[model samples]
Target: MQLKKALKSLVPPSLQARIRTWKAERAIAVFEAEWRESRRNAARIQVRRPIERILLVPPDPGTLMGALGDDAMVTSVVEMARARNPEVEIEVLTGRPVASEMAVAHGLKPVEIWESPHFVRDLDALLTKRRYDAVVALGADIMDAYHDFLGSAKMIAVVDLPARRGIPSSVLGFSFNARPNPRLAAHFAGVSPDVRFRLRDEISFERFGRFSPATSELVADSAFVLTPGAVADDLGAWIDAMHADGRKVIGINVHPMLFRDATDEQIATIVQRGADALLACAETARVAWLLLPHDYRGRLGDAVCLEPIRDRVAGILGDTVRHLDGRHRASTLKAVAGRLDGVVSGRMHLAIATLGMGVPALCATYQDKFEGLYRHFGLPDWLLLSPESFLVEGTFRDALARFIQQLPELTRIVGARREAVLALSRQNFTIFDDVAQTARIGSAGQGGSPAPVQDA
Candidate 1:
């Protein structure tokens, strides 16, 4: 380590960055080569049976900072599955000890297979030992190489391994960027044909269909079916008071993704601008504001990033503005969101929660995922704010004002499509039925009654 540090100190910072980039590219190339070769040599296992046991792989392995969105997906899937078959056994794979607690809290059996360096080997052992009838990989917009390429590769492997083993594996509803990483896309294209890839939107479906059309299907995000949990008493009362005063309560979620690649000074400036925009909207519309934090992942969490902006908004707006000071589960946050008249959110899942509750949301988008979400409501251009433009002076304030003004129209549109969206969201779990059918067809008279499948 000392020798490497000394060598790095001898090179220019610019040169070091170039070297890192080159190394990453080389690593991706190597992974792709190995992946293609493995696909070519993979032997298919045919052990068809009823869907009694399921292994759920969440996007995050669970850390000090957990992803509420991923939790929402996992919880939603588990609830829907149990509602269908009360006797189905579900095991959630956890990487960290804390993740086990999360799984247990949701009444799931936690399987620790991520502590080992040989992740695939450990996963294989767990599958063999546990004999999971199905593997459901929750691909919540992290299966691409845009960030965390190795993580993306691991997610792919989670589904690929089970599918190849004829254990009925599938990636749950997910989104893809406009231009995905070529190597990752290539690897996805080569995965077992039986492994299903469910894209959350038409845009992502179109993108993935380019190479993996046979396995890819269009579905909605699983979080859409998440049930709302109770909110804090004080927060609930505050919102009630605001409603009693005839004020429109609006929720806002500011995310750290907006500060990606930004300097400290730029981040501070952005926060100040965001605060200014919120203040303007609050005063202009006489609206009560709730500062919601969706992600709680340490420094990158929305709560930490929103602190400065929240402070600023509260300093002036005082009682009219409230920041969620504690970390809450996705369901509880959804409950809080459901009470609001409308929302302006940087996090997609928070927006999903609000929209799922028949409330309007103006999404400040950091990725290509939000467009399809808004499209689901039939208002494709329904006040979609770009993060770059949100930083511009007066832009966010104007957008927020416009969103508030058009709330009734947007709300009507959202309500009109709410049932359709829910249906699509529930379709995310139909992979269970698909696999169960395959089992029945592949092993007719196998001497066991298949687990009953239910509508989501």
Candidate 2:
């Protein structure tokens, strides 16, 4: 590990990114070829009616703890499924033995993605034995090969195999970058028509339409349905105290990914300037700041990245600046976010949570996903900040001050579109229902036997 870190330190950030992209593209190409060949020989499947069993594949590998955004997606789907059918057996595919707290709380069974040495044979055996009524893949930005190419390929295979068998299958609401990986796009273009695809934003919908127009539909992200849970007593008390003191409370989420390309000195400089800016904004605006951490993936977590800035700001401002220093669930954090007047978040889900509560958010944009999210609130180009621009001195403070100034209007806009956004988010599950019903009709027409469908 030390040697690997040393080697990584020697390479420039731009070149490292290029190398990673090349590797992902090559692996995707190889996987696509093998997958196409397998589909050519695969037999069709027949699904039974009154959908009782569901197989949900999340974007993350192990427990749903790596990223809150991924966890919110899984949680929303499970909750919505149960609300529709209390007895629906929902099993989540995980790479680890243990499931997340949210999964256990929701009574979701965790099934290992790889249970044997033979990937294809094992999945086939499991599916045939379990006899699932439907298969849903949470394609949250991974289908584009920009995040995890291997995870994207695995999700596609899981959905494709079951889909070829005539079972209800869909890739749940997901996003595509401005320029998606060509190999991945081509692969989706040729996927079986029986598989349903839902895009979360206009940008992704417009881009995906060029390839799979017939299969893709525009829908809002499922995270919009996540309900707020209770906040920690201490955090709640702090917010109440701030309000009692006639101070406007603002929340901020900082992550290391925003500074992934910076040197150590550059990171320190950026953090120092960011703290100075926050202090300045607080002094002028009479705002008390809440340092919120959304992701908890070891070194990459927002908590690890925000500690230094938190210390610096708190040392000077005392109780006016506080850091939420513990492991908290996504819903709990959402509840805390709801108490804030506005939020500036490096993580998209944190922004989603705040906005869902009718609070204004300035998203620190990455991977081009935030544009569509902002569009959902009817305020495109109003509250967005690029990492490149944020790294410069004064940019962070300038953006924060401006965001604070526009909070009232932004909150009004978010409130006006809140119901519409929730309605669109509900459409994700409705699409699954529509496909399942259509599959049922098709099954009944053929005497409840597997329909003979051509392989892609």
Candidate 3:
């Protein structure tokens, strides 16, 4: 069964799509069709055409929700790389078990995983034995730790989100009265020339560009390119029932951690506001609401907030207001979200994933990362923001009121802009492919000396 599924990936993408539709209709009993859906979405865009060998280095993984998010990000990157060069041989030097677990959840198989407690030794051993065409550093600090082992591989550094202390002191250069960190300068300086660096957004690009020695470009977060797979029939039945009653479904996801700093009154106010917002929307707009939990793990996960909100809203809407069980994976949440009319989430990744699926989602963002993404989607006002504001009396109520007003238009806008948003995401890897191929050509074109991992 696994081999048959694996062989399916080798078929042409158009045929694969048709095959999936045919299989889905026939109820062919495929165990993990969503994984195949993700790959099909991936095949729609590529940066190069045929990368022979590529190595991806991921950061230390987190628990369920975070891990799934990271997997989505990495998978998007890998698919983008594959788009650049079709039939590329890829390996994720998978370090943490969390990441590998996510790989299983996503049904991305034939993964070449290299795991070890001794990361440095394992990394060096792998690189020393295999000559990869390119090495994509998924995290910023990977170079600092593994500088010595890269050898001649084309190194592509991706500048990830929520950048810390941008415009590294090294780029300003030594002034008569000012000096930069030698270590920072040396690390970036040692990058193999022709190395391509990608910043997740324009804001990060502007912040990181001056310090980077390699050509840097702006690209959408890879998560925006991933597509969700199918959900269980039981869940589907719930969605069908909701729609059958002629009530549009609006999904709500509030991160429990959002209430950590709030007072008892403030927390209650926020929850009440969410419940009230649902009631108001349902009454005015003729809709039902579901509590969507994007993050499924940890002390203050989505389930924690979702259960309370469900209880609070249950009296108002009864069975019309149900919350999802916390057991579903992130992909499962996304699959269910596809049935929603629109979504309001505090979890940014959920918004991105849902929006990528062309679901109009409102975000309750708390960082700069959120702004760049919403801006890319062409719906800047779709987010309700600030942790501080949630503490202020009536702030959430006011915000929710505004969001309710925008929901209808927001949905239409997302439906219209979905293709453009995806096009921007694909641009990231197109630039990435150009960078990787340049590094590859440079290495071969010049018989380049081994890139020195030394002090600047």
Candidate 4:
């Protein structure tokens, strides 16, 4: 609309009107064609890297997978790695037990799941036991921990976290490559020397399933999963009200990462708010409750979708939601999102996955990323619990109502956002292609020298 308006300003009024009409139609066609070809090229680049033996370290289960998104990251990584090196071997190390089980279920060849306490020891054992050559740690885990624990791999890549913290120096220590956590990458530039910085924004999300069979199944089966268990004062009441309104609730059992390092009082405040939200939502509805703990004995009426995943991590839950097994985590979440009328929750990824799968989602967000994603898609009105507007009476419900009423608009906005995001993925793929080529050159250069194992 604006493009035509601008183009018409310089022409005669009668000619401008005609020009605007033609320009609008022509611009859309050109944009769409360019977008499609860009997506195809990006898909080729993501799988083009010959990642033959990769060890992926993922955030603990409850934490949102930044690089991985909703479908398991390890599964995507292994599949992409193998496609590059048909003989590629992939293994995953995760803090969350459920993540490990999900990785396997998602059909990542074979993996060894490790709790964080045992991360160092288990990593050493695996490194010694196999001929692993690469390591990929999701987001800031590479900066915070993995740099100290890397194996004798020739190359290591990290999905850069959002740059609000600072320029991540860790990427410089190895071959600095990045995924679309642009904020983190921006900060890292000021702090570290500019080496060959490879920005990998090209993400062929729609084509992800093509690279990994498990991802395809997960995408095909994804459903809405809601974790309304924020410690907000009215959570339980909200659940009860939703039930009264004829809503079918799916209980999500994951914990948030922001409060991971908070003080006890702060943590309690978040937990209580979560509990209130759950109680509100669960009371009026016969919610199909999915939990995380094996021993949770809560019976919110006759509706129970209990699928316990063993070796749980944190007990710092804000709300008292139930747990499902890791194996069923991906499928179950997908199933819930798919069947739901809609979702209103605090879980960021749950909402992200919901929108990605074409379901309308309302985020009761406590962080910038929540609003960031919605704003990224031009759906800022759908954000319920912005950091500035949380915990007020009826704020959550109003947001929920607004989202439900605007489902069609929300869906349209999400569709556009999906296309733009997928296009960004294609843009990033060009960088991945360059990096893969460079890595091969670096490997050849090193081949001139004897392969000597370096100690950390």
lDDT of 4 by residue, 1-456 (tens): 999888767678898688777765554344333322322322111222443455555543333232224343333344445546667655655445555566566455335434323333344345445544444543322322223322211112121111111111111111112232222221222211211222121122222212211100001101122221122234445445555755554443323333434454543343444445445554444343334221122332101212211112123222333333323333335444544456654555556556655666766444333543465466766455653233354554444445555666777877777655444323211222232322221110111111112111
Report the alpha-carbon TM-score of model 1 versus the true structure: 0.84
Alpha carbon deviation, residue 11, candidate 4 (Å): 83
Per-residue alpha-carbon lDDT of model 3 for 1-456, expressed as tens digits? Answer: 999989987899999899877754433222113212221222111222245666555543222125556556676666666676666666654435765676556443223333322333334345445545555555422232233222111122111100110111001000010122334433344343444455555545554545445445555666676657677787678778978987677788876567555455655665766766676656666567788776656645666566777887789788788777646555566677778877878876787778877787766765334666676667866365776655565666566657666767877878887888677666545433332233332111221322333312
What TM-score would candidate 4 get against the native?
Answer: 0.45
TM-score of each: 0.84, 0.84, 0.67, 0.45
Model 4: lDDT equals 0.37
Give the range of the ten consecutive residues with the poorest summed lDDT in model 3: 168-177
User: Residue 24 in candidate 1 has what lDDT?
Assistant: 69
- lDDT, candidate 1, 25-90, per-residue tens: 665555444444444444444443445678888888764127778778988888877776778888
Clashes of each: 0, 2, 11, 53
Order of candidate numbers by TM-score, starting with the best: 2, 1, 3, 4
**What is the per-residue lDDT of model 2 for residues 1-456, given as tens digits with 9 covering 90 to 100?**
999999999999999999998876665555555565556666665554455788888877476546788878888887888776778898877676655444566688777753323445556667767878788888888887776656665676777777777677788888877766554544564556667677788778877776443366678888888988898788899899999998889998877677655566656765776688888898778789988989887767776557888888887789998888888878888899999999889898898888888888988887677998898888858478887665687888888898888887888999999899888788778634543434322110121222222222
Q: Give the TM-score of candidate 2.
A: 0.84
Better of 1 and 3 by TM-score: 1
Greater lDDT among 1 and 4 belongs to 1
Candidate 2, residue 85: the lDDT equals: 76
Better of 3 and 4 by lDDT: 3
